[model samples]
Target: MSLPKSRLLVIGCVWPEPNSSAAGSRMLQLLQFFLAENYKITFVTTSARSEFAVDLEKMNITSEVIKMNHPSFDEMLKRISPDLVLFDRFMTEEQFGWRVDEICPEAVKILDTEDLHFLRKTRIEAFKKNIPAEEIYFDADITKREIASIYRCDLSLIISEVEMKLLQKEFNIPQNLLHYLPFLLEPISEEEKLSLPAFKNRKDFISIGNFLHEPNWNAVLYLKEKIWPLIRQELPDAKLNIYGSYPSQKIWNLHNEKEGFIVQGRAENAEIVMKNAKVCLAPIQFGAGLKGKLIQAMQCGTPSITTAIGAEGIAGALDWNGFITNQPKDFAQKAVQLYSEENLWENSAENGFRIINSRFNKEAFQHKLSERLLNLIQNIATYRQKNFIGKMLQHHQHRSTYFMAKFIEEKEKR
Candidate 1:
């Protein structure tokens, strides 16, 4: 008889909405990986389901709405008895980790930090203060909390290599406790590359991201206030189309037909919109992890112009799909250059395809992750022994978080 399949529990901060945001897409990719491995997967989230949320039931994955600071979760944990618990983000891990430890001590706890929250928060703070992001507030309260969460978990999956280095070099997080995993994507083939809308077929400048993201909103504001006018001056007929989910009234108000700056909120198909665009503009001043919009641009064969922050960790040692510049004048000049020059545009698009194939190949990453996880599972005791700091943090976190949560739960009883 076949042995029982390994059980995997994913505690999400929110239900996966792949169309809405990069975080959502990342969650879905992870779920797909476990599903392919034949793991029995159950996804639980406390967040309210939105219309855009993926139908987990349709995918044959068990999904349940879970409550915070409740005994129900403890009872459910006993019933499912997952062999592996995957925390969607540091916040979810903070909320439910103690219960997981108490209920299932033997289970391997994994934290998937969608991005380093403290890093993004710090960068945004630095941006507001007109300071270099490199001057990060290492002693910030959020840094302490986030780093503590990392230490509490048996392993934390870091999305960016840059972040992996930061955690190791700056915070002295052990290499055994962290794993680098970027967006896993299939390589774009030659036929597929040929099939994409040629440089001549595509038109206009496009910038798309989830507006709920502060960096995207900031970039949109930057475009409206600083960059778009310069690009429009060079090519008066050219339009900059802004597309994203959750555009507020203020974002919509940025639209001006005469100015050729259009805010088209929430593209039904991001790939379609991306494919039709001549040049993608992302003036992301502050953000963390991979920029999915840029990757999607590369996938769609559209060259882009972005800031150093926008290109971070996505393109490594290779020519960028288009141009990277911090100056508004140079940014606009390159946007026009990329849009008008077909040969330059083709070369940049090819560079994007090359980057995708070389760096983010899905098969290579999946195989490596599979091997690492299997090894980790087989040597769980040895792994934990090597991470003594994790154990210490876990002990303290359980003591403090346990009673605090219990108190909240009891108060809710009244």
Candidate 2:
């Protein structure tokens, strides 16, 4: 007889929008992994549903709308009695973690930190002040809250290697509490590479990302104010096509056919647009985590030029797909070279394939995550025993957040 399937509960900040953001894609990947492991998955979120959100029902996963500061959630949690509880981000954990602990004390809690919010926030602040991001204060309020959430969980899935090192080396977080899991992608084969459009067939420079993200918005602004002009000077005929979701009127205003800078908002098919482009340009001044746009470019056999921050944690020791530079002039020069030189473009595309196959093998990461989860589930008591800090944080957080939420719930009722 088959054994009973394990139940997994996921509390999300928002419903997954795979077409609109990288965070959506990452969440879907995790759900798929859990499904593959035969877990009965239920996804709940306090945020209102978006039209762009993926249909979890179609994937055989159950989803529900939940409310905050409500005791009804505790009853729901008790009924589900999940074997594991995965929080979409630190914010989600802060909201529901105390209740989950009270309702299902035995459930293993995990935090999938899509990116370090504190790091990204600090970097953006530094950028605004005309200061180096490296010099920003690391112990901000957000940092403390996020780190506390990390410690309160049994495991925190970090999306970037650089972030993993920062948590360990800089913040002195225990290595056992963290797991490095970047974007999980399929390996590109020779047949797939041959099927991609050749350099001669592809034209123009393309930039695509979700505009809702501050970094993508900032990159587009930087391109318009700094990088695009330099590229226009070199190749006046060449156009830079900008595609992204949720483009504001200000972004649409950047469109100029005469200048060969086009803002085509919200790509219906990201892969098609990416594959047809000769070169991808991402002049990201500040951000955190892996860039989905750059990875999509590589998957489509299109080379790219991005900043050191944009390329961070993705390429490891391997050579980048095209070029890495923060200087606008040098960035434009590389974009021109990558677009015009067929041999260089082909080599860069090849390098991208190597990086994907070697660094982000889907099967390897899935296996690693599966093993880790199983080990944690089996030895949860021992794991929690070793994590005295986590226990202490949970004890205090439960009391503080519980009373605060109770007060709020009572106020709302009144």
Candidate 3:
């Protein structure tokens, strides 16, 4: 008899837009792993496809549109009967997790929390209020739901070691249930590094991210109001170019060529722009997970001067690609130093290559994850048994969410 094909189902909060957001790039990386393993993957999302959304079909992945809080989803789950179901974010899991639990009891439930939403929310709130982020706690309503989702799932992929530690130390999530899976990137070769724009060839200070992300927009505001003036004061000739996708008119309003604080909207080619830039500045005041622009800066052999928050999770014990300072004055000073000082710039850029190679070896992570998946598949019952809290949450929360969803579905029908 022929063996059955291995199947996987992925529920995305939005269609992948690798060019538009780091989250999108991370999702694509996850897809590449399953593709390499020859898994038959189906991606389902309620989100309408945007022009920027990646064409999964072209990549040999099937995508289907599914409705939220509806019976049709249950039928779709039964029809596919996947070996694994991965939720893109906590919200997606909250909506469809119960159905997956009820329909495909044997399927491994994986929650890929791009970042701890609660932490991001907490930081953003704190930053806006001009207070310390420590004010936020785990008892928030979103925290309750997110942690419960983590417990109920077979495994959750955390992008940062800091977050993985946070889950274990603060929330008491089991080590087995949370895996630290940062950006799975291939190691950069010496040839690749040499090919990147040299310190002499690159110019200007660049920062790039998805403007739709609140933290990125906030960083742009921070640069304009507090950070840029200080830097531009000392190096009057240097320009600070802000590039991002989906920039609104408000972002456009910030553009002033006279001041050289150019709001260059939506990069045509992210890598090309990064490679040509002298220094990348990401003075992020708030957010969670690793920042993609910082990683790209390193990949393109560009040094960066970011904050403690911006450098979080990605730097590990190693020295940062450039500098990490929370103070506005110091941040601006470092940006100038990095842009003008060739020795510092080259050293910082090399440090980035080191971090990427040491921390995010794609092949190593993929092998380990594959092994863990196989073990989980073989011992699903026993694994679930150990997670008693998960079972409890699944039992009670599942029923509550199911009825709530049913009521909404019925209301829609009426």
Q: What is the TM-score of each candidate against the true structure?
A: 0.98, 0.98, 0.97
lDDT digits (tens) for residues 25-94 of candidate 3: 9999999998887888999999988888889999999998899988999998888899899999999988
Judge candidate 1 against the unseen true structure and give its global Cα lDDT, from 0 to 1. Answer: 0.92
Show the lowest summed lDDT stretch of 10 residues, model 2: 1-10
Extract clashing residue pairs from model 1: none
Better of 1 and 3 by TM-score: 1
Write the residue-wise lDDT of candidate 1 on 1-414 in tens digits. Answer: 111338999999999989889999999999988888988999999998889899999989998999999999999999999999999989999999999999999998999999999999999999899987667768678898899899888888999888999899988999988999999999999899989999878889999999889999999999999999998889999999999999999999999999999999999988899999999999999999999999999999999999999999998899999999999999989999999999999999999999999999988899888877887888889998887778898889889998999899999999
Once superposed on the true structure, which residue ranges of model 1 sit more than 4 Å away at CA? 1-5
How does candidate 2 fare on TM-score? 0.98
Candidate 3 segments exceeding 4 Å error: 1-5, 130-134
Model 2 per-residue lDDT tens digits across residues 1-414: 111338999999999988888899999999988888888999999999888899999999999999999988998998899989999999999999999888898889999999999999989999899887657656578888999999999999999999999999988999889999999899999999999999999999999999989999999999999999988898989999999999999999999999999999998888899999999999998999999898888889999999999999999999999999999999989988888899999999999999999999999998898888877877889999999988899899989998999999999999
State the weakest 10-residue window (summed lDDT) of model 1.
1-10
Residue pairs with clashing backbones, model 3: none
